[model samples]
Target chain A: MLYLVGLGLHDEKDVTVRGMEAIKGSERVYLEAYTSILGVGKERLDAFYGKDIVVADRDMVEMDSDEILRDADKVDVAFLVVGDPFGATTHADLLLRADALSIPYTVIHNASVMNAVGALGLALYNYGQTVSIPFFTDSWRPDSWLERVRENMRLGLHTLCLLDIKVKEQSEENLARGRKIYEPPRYMSVPTAISQLLSLLEDSSPSASSDSSPSLASADSLDPSTTLAISASRVGAPSQRFVAGTLAELSELDEEAFGGPLHSFVIVGRRFHALERDFAGRWAVDRERWNEVSNTVYAVRD
Target chain B: MLYLVGLGLHDEKDVTVRGMEAIKGSERVYLEAYTSILGVGKERLDAFYGKDIVVADRDMVEMDSDEILRDADKVDVAFLVVGDPFGATTHADLLLRADALSIPYTVIHNASVMNAVGALGLALYNYGQTVSIPFFTDSWRPDSWLERVRENMRLGLHTLCLLDIKVKEQSEENLARGRKIYEPPRYMSVPTAISQLLSLLEDSSPSASSDSSPSLASADSLDPSTTLAISASRVGAPSQRFVAGTLAELSELDEEAFGGPLHSFVIVGRRFHALERDFAGRWAVDRERWNEVSNTVYAVRD
Candidate 1:
């Protein structure tokens, strides 16, 4: 049997009880590393599981999936994922291949950001098309993500904006040279994302730059500063931290002392359910933070 | 302190390790009974936790939220929810109320359909505006959901069509009579959802219904019966069972054989990674299962 387990959004212990059992029962355990990583390192999970793990990066999972599934018919094999096994499509592929090979398999689910975003207090039902805002460079920035966000906001729906993470990414030169070298891993911060969002909105719509605008970009529905709530959550951990604030304030905000890799952002949309607004207010305690948040516009409400 | 914890997708054991701790630590543990239900009854969770759980319906959480948080200032309290803590907007309201009352709050995350739709083998990043497909009525059926699906297919993005559940829903007649009775809960099945999708597609594009015209649904992108998969997953449980097949096959599927209630369906979109396709293929042995997936026209085709 081949088991695909979701380790959830935080550390090693985030694995479901069932997932842990599957790992313990499996003859081979592999942690797919590239698509997503646990907030804590693999060693932590290894320590918890009391087993040596084979870390499968993109190349191994994508390029060598068949080899990974070998002999699954002979004994139990477990493939561990950072979040729910299905949170990422790569595992689904592995499952499909297992099926093709007629290998029996089961999936163990776990907490992931899709539902975890509620930490900032947004309704999952009210959330619309989720978009990823990738880190942009001088030459290759994409704005289609903005269009999607605009569409989501137009419907009074909340948007969960996933920031880009470049892991083991090869620079163009390195790729062309066929070098094995990789660029440093980059996890986009809520603040950096906000700065880019502001610039892009300003560049797309001239009116957005006006002084009278209530800190909302061109697609303002609520004052962006007042509506945005960010959580620097290292979820699935005992010490997981979640601090909310507007995007503008979040940009200037610095306190994720939550150790290492993987952080995403949420762009709070308009249409408060009373509770959403209330949950968001919890993060705006300090006067300086309040001032920072006050500078954003949610939608360009007429 | 008030903690809103998601019990996760299926049952009592679905509760995360953190959520379990919160339940054990809370002075009051209230399970919101309206938005959704776990696979098991409150008694089961109570037995597992060795504590009594108060079931909070709409009245208590909304009209009398102050009562729930009243003691939070002086005690640790938890509002338990099925799925992720903020999976529903109602919890957000509860959190907001707590914040207003000066109660510190926290959210514990868990797996939910929002992320679990990958069960059908679509890339999470490739899914476009998710829309709920409500069970149609004799008079109130709306095809509006088709637009979102079409838009997603256009962009080659998968559409995670969240099947609507009517829990604690008021009936028009009951409301008119000032009665407080709720209609029975409903969970949509794949065959039914497919029927709705086919009807709406044919209705909107009548010209495409020529005798020999492709089934209005194409299999060029994926083999529906082979690629399409259905999961009657009683997730977060020991006996969870998931099956994949053509809408026609799964529609006729006996989920009782799979396990129990709270089943969801995924309408596969065109854009899929090679791995995703392979993984989704594992769920079903039929090609038509995969053929059911359509490419949304509005997505960025990335």
Candidate 2:
């Protein structure tokens, strides 16, 4: 039997009781680490579960999944994911492989940013397709997510932008030299994501330099100064932080307050209800500033 | 502090270890009962946790939230939700009230059907805005969800149709008579939802009776015979069942196999990847029929 368990977004104790039971009964446990990072380390999880977990990198999970599911037909083998097992396609692929091998599997679900982002007070139903914003480089800058954001905005739906995190990645120089040296892990912060978005929007504007082609046709519709947005850091954690304001205000927020790793950004849509605005106001870094933007955007009722 | 913990989708053991701790340390624990139903009863949870729990219906949580939060600042109060704390807007509202009252709170995240639907092998990112289909009555038949389905289909995004569940609801006569009488709980089965959808579609067709006006402008975009869909019953439960096929094929599925309660439906969009098609094919009630529909819709990449 293959047990696909989700370690919910925080400490080791966030794993469901059923998941814990599955881990206890499993002969071998593998934690898929490339997709997302947890607040705690493997040693902490090991201490909590009273068993050592084999860390499965991208290569092992994507290329050699058979090894993870080896003898699963005979005994229980646990495959752990940071968020919900199906949040990423790779995890789903794990299930696919298990199915093809005639291995019975059980999925234990946990809270993921896909649903946890509702903490920012936006109705879950009001959210459209979620988009991931990757780090932009000089040579490989992509603006594909811009279209997704625009589609949500066009429909008056909130858009949850998942920031990119590069873990166990090798540098170009190291890769070229056939070196196994890896670069430090990098997690995109809200301010960094906002700056990248601003640059992209500016470059796409009609008044920008002639060499700069618009990445999105509806670029004119988004105004950074007036468009309300929310940024959350370390969601589902004890130290979770949320700041609600305009894109411009959020871009200039205090980094010391937001602190380290795992930040999510939400672009508020035009169809804001009075209740949503009221709820968002409670999380504002500057209540006065948030209300100013909210007044301009939200159609608040008495 | 107030602890809003999620009881992840299965039995009593589905609660996270952290959630259990919260409940253990809580002076008062109230389970929100109206938004979603859990597979287990209060007695089961009480027996597992060795703690007494008070069930908070919609009235208590929505109208008398202050009562639930009474002395919360002075004591450790646990408000348990079936899925993720923020899966429903009412839970978010509770957070708002708590915030307004300056009460500190912690959210324990758990798996929600929003992400758990990935069991069908569909990517979570590929799903668009979720729609809720309510039980249609003679005078209260609503087709608003049809517009949502149309928009998602237009964008080539999968749509998760959340079937409505009526619990502890009062009849109009009971309400007007100032009586506390409640109606028996009614959970919409997949077949019932599909039949209602089919009827709505047929009624809106131009070829139908002259008195019937088409609610959908692009009525031709959706065809029941060719559109692929998936239905799952008792998701996240030990006895969970999944059936995938074209809309027409699923509309006639046997209810005995689905059995008891808690069912969800999904409408496959136009842009299905080959991997998605292959994965979804595994749950097909009729593989040959599913493949026939898939080949016409999916852009297979081999």
- Summed backbone clashes in each candidate are 57, 1
The top-ranked prediction according to TM-score is 2
lDDT of 2 by residue, B1-302 (tens): 99998898977889999999999999989999988889989999998877899999988898999988988899999999998888865366788788789898888889888878877888888788999999999898899898888888888788999899999999999999989999999999888888888888787775543333222323235677767899988889988888898777888877775777899889988667777887888889889878766775554454
Model 1 agreement with the true structure over A1-302: per-residue lDDT tens digits: 99888888877656666678889899889998776777677788788888789988889988898888999998999998888887744465566678779898877777777667666656665566667888898798788888777666666567777778788999989999999999888887666777788778667666643456454343444344555655555555556555666655566665453344456666666554443554555555454554344333432222
**TM per prediction:** 0.79, 0.94
Best by lDDT: 2
Per-residue accuracy of model 2 over A1-302 as CA lDDT, tens digit each: 99999898988999999999999999999999998889999999999998899999998988999999999999999999998888865366777889889999998888888888877778889888999999999898789888888888888788899999999899999989989898999999999899999899887875543433222323235677667889889988888888888787888876775778899889998667777788888778788877766664554454
Q: Which ten residues in a row have the lowest lDDT in candidate 2 chain B?
A: B211-220
lDDT of 1 by residue, B100-152 (tens): 68888776777776776666556676666667788888887687877666555
Predicted complexes: DockQ each: 0.44, 0.68
